[model samples]
Target: MRHAGRALACLALLSSLAVAAPAAAQDDGVAPLPDDFLWGVSSSGFQSEGNGPDSNWLRYTEEQEDKEDVGASVDFRHRYAEDIALAADMGVEVYRFGIEWARVEPAPGAWDQAELAYYDDVVRHVLDAGMTPMITLNHWVHPGWVADQGGWRSEETLRDFTAYAESIVERYAGLGVMWVTFNEPTLYVYHEIDNGAATWLDAPWLFDRLARAHSAAYDFIHEADPGAMVTSNLAFIPLTPWLFDAAFIDRIAHELDFVGIDYYMGVSLDNLTAARTLTGGLADAQPDGIYYALRYYANKFPDLPLYIVENGMATHDGAARPDGLSRAEFIEDHVYWLQRAREDGIDVIGYNYWSITDNYEWGSYTPRFGLYTVDVQGDPSLTRVPTSGVDAYAAVIADGGVPAGYDPVVPESVCSLIDPPLSCLVPAS
Candidate 1:
């Protein structure tokens, strides 16, 4: 295993170099957000709309007691209309959601027309609600046939993914939907590698294959839906420089029409000296870190229209953070930073909170990042309870931005040194 200290230091150095560069030179900050900025919310089929389909993740959660068995996650499969209605009420112009590959392709060479009809209905609903549908081609789930055929590790899997991508885009060509070829491809590869669920391919090779798959899908999507924009969303992890491969970026750069960045936690390489570091410290959790992280990617991919495709703070069981950073405060803090990024000339076209409601978070239901919390374990009705953040987000969507001078309402002492400097700070109330 790599030494954590050494790993973090290298990450910090890269981050410093990235930040020191001029944003304009980086090809970011040149374009203002287009009038059609796709402010939106995001959800995955397996994670949010729980309708059992015998996925590897489902089996993993059920077989492992330590993992949270998300049997009936917000039940979006049954309640998409209600959930999407909530999103429409927020005045968001887009709804980014995934169509599970496993559900559509339950067996090899056998596609379910009903599955396509379901998504067609959902996509139509989104359009009817006055929101564009941004569909993710694959959100880390594969058909059982592929899983049985050694998954993405197999060379055949790459061909399968390409075929799958081509089929879906061709099927839904005229829906006026935007397409995300893949969601967090790096994380998906990492998860498969770390969990021993896949073999025969390492990270580098997996990335190479993914790059090919994305490139192929990119062309197909454009050919299928000439008006559609396409990209492969990247999971941004600041201070983990090794996680980034410039060569891979170069390869996919031509293939992408825009950049989808999923910024979450922040880390600094200078763990010992920096006030904020990723090493189990309060600073690691501060929302300003998100701003810096976005700026970093904005600089990295200067010419591309950037969308914060996934971002949200997690709380233990939807409980308030010790620092008094409630869900509302978290949303405000992140939004303030987002506005700052925009003012600085980042071509940020959209923002999608990780989820509209709490769902199965990989293995655990405890770390809730939802605007509405779902009783995953206890409630038979599985009601979605609105968090304090729900009203805040609704207001943000209505205004098309965070209220001017919005800052977290919590006391500075709670965040200690990690709190934003009060010099230009203004309260949102």
Candidate 2:
């Protein structure tokens, strides 16, 4: 482990970066990120693509009384051209989306060519739009057949998932695509247990299965597409990264080419507002925690690059956030910290905003996190309305990042537990 000298090395790198990197705008603070830094948008197959497939999430929504029905969510399956165009218009360089397992393989060992071709069209469209495709193999939804065969509980799941990953990678290899073996595997385990798919006693076994799946997939993805970047993104649970990352990320750290972090909210000693995520309510925003998240991962995996796989604020039904934070401000605030992270010598390479349009958020359509907001339940047409975030994001991408001298809309929290003692002792500039 190179941790012994990491702190001093990081300090030295910070000083060197200050003198070496040129500022894009105002010189005192935030500097322009590298020209090759990836700016992208993200969406998952299950959440954005309407026309339901037989899957665990569909069943979860149907069986649970409180869960809202996911009826033709934003109809991305039919309207992807418009959606991709919207993202391309924003000048994004990457388009990250999932290839739905349930939709592609409805039955065990059976692949649907039509569904596969639909994804082919989507990828080709993205390429035509000049965005690199980032394909996620699994995003918390598997075929109902897989779910019926014990889901992640049985050891058999590991083998089946690896096979599924191999098939997908073979199809998309050499297409200049980035691969995410599994999306937020830790949260995948949480949702499985939370939805009664598994029990608390089965948590460790589930984690092991996911870790094994990712490790196996990593080898094959690289075998098929040499020099490919592969990772299973982790949802950054502020203040308790160890609690969340321990079982999953620790198990597959060596296999990762880059650290993929999905950060949304932060919690402090005085503010436990992040609890809202548990109840499907909009979590209170803490933009500065993003800086700590990057710093933490950079310190732990000093040799690997970092990517913000997903980061965006959520609103309830297009309503103003209770904290009065707009999506536009959220984008600027987070990007400002990203620039700061890079200036401090973090090997940060890319960022993908959570989504292109609002869709069914897990079991409910209440929380909206999209650059172009959509009224999933109320509007039959599913029109994509441009939010203030659209203009803000376009400007951010055009300028290479938030303007220099830019400060976050929400100030850093006191004694934030994002990185505990280190974060509290040495607050970021």
Candidate 3:
């Protein structure tokens, strides 16, 4: 962790230099993106697919107080086909989802063929819909057996995790699948600490183990799939990336084929929306902050491409956001920034909206970020109601990006803390 902090110091200094550097010329209009730019939607197995095998998360939810019962969440386990078709109908180019470790390997040294076959079916459906399948190998849920062995705190769990990763890559490698070895490894540690799986003192050891797991899995994925691109997406924490990326991303920096970033909010002296992060509630929209996120990564990993593995707006239980930003405006506003980043020479290859449908958000289903809203609590049918974002996203994809001279519905924040002195000193246009 100390070594990582040194690396973070270097990165922080590099970012600080942006304050002295001149901002790139603001383009008068956004141009058409490259033909291969991927437009996709994202979801995780534990968050969306219900009737799941027992795991650390399931146990945590069971024991925790005041958590919403995540019963048959959007029932994606039984209704994936319908959901895949919904995405296809919107001309989505890719479908990013997770293959649950608990479901496929419920016990140590044991495998479940039925659950594996279910994931096979899900992948086939996505391909049948003429979309690419981006599979996340872990989304912070492991089998109860692993938890019993002390979760990520034990060396034994790390060994087992690598084995599971190899098993999954071996199975899905040939299916033209893109792989995410872990979803937000930093956040994974935070959640584990929050759930009593580990203590703050254990964070350094846990991060080391996660880095080892991802590095081993990266080799296994490529050895099996050859052409497969792999990443463990980072949940971009504005202004303080060094605090989050130091222990994980810095360790596995060399292992990544591309940088996977999930940017959902921004902080500023005036707008303290980031405080909501502690509660998993809807944060205020910071559309322009995404440009800084992209630019930051573009500078950090100049040779590798950047992908927005997860980006979207969350509303409280399908209702409009308190800030009055509509789901549609959020879509257009962010895409506008994406185009700007591209025009400024950022090599961004893909953008996957945070989710296709609303599902359990870690502890509760209250923070809804899905493009297609679902009534997980009230509707027995689990109806998939299209938000205005549906049409907005489709149009963005069809037109290659937001049209020339488009203006964001939400204005850029003043003195944004997203990238510290850089963002504050030289705000993006």
Candidate of highest TM-score: 3
- TM-scores of the models, in the given order? 0.83, 0.93, 0.94
- Candidate number that wins on TM-score, 2 or 3: 3
Q: Write the per-residue lDDT of candidate 3 for residues 1-429, one digit (tens) a residue.
A: 755664565457556654223346556677778889999999999999997778999998898886767789998999999999999998899899999999999988899999989999999999999999999988999999999999999999999999988988898778889999999998999999989999999999999999999989998888899999999999999977766777788788889999999998888877787787677556788888888888777766778999999998888887777689998899899998888788767888999998999999887888888888898888888899899999999999999888888878888788888767666765565
List where candidate 2 sits over 4 angstroms from the true fold: 1-27, 278-280
For candidate 2, the clash count comes to 0
Question: How much is the lDDT of residue 70 in candidate 3?
Answer: 76
Model 3 clash tally?
Answer: 0
lDDT of 3 at 336: 86
The whole-model lDDT of each prediction reads 0.71, 0.86, 0.87
Report the lDDT tens digits of candidate 2 across residue range 1-429: 334454455465555543222233335778888889999999999898987689999999999998988889998999999999999999999999999999888888899999999999999999999999999999999989899989998777888888888998999899999999899988898889999999989999998888889999999998999978998999998765766778799889999999999988887765678787676666678887888888888777878999999998788888888789988999999998889888778889999998889978888888888999999887888899999999999999999898777877787788777866566555674
lDDT of 1 by residue, 1-429 (tens): 545654454355455543322232222212223456677899989998786686667767777777877777888888899889988887878898899888888877788888878888898899999998999988888776787777776799899888888888888898888888878887788778766776544667787888899889988888878988888888765544334635255569877778887876643332212343334223335565555555555655677877888988777786566556677777776776666667666677788987888888788778788887887888888887888878988777666556554544522222212112211121111
- Candidate 1 matches the true fold with a TM-score of 0.83
Q: Between the candidate structures 1 and 3, which one is better when assessed by TM-score? A: 3
lDDT ranking of the models: 3, 2, 1
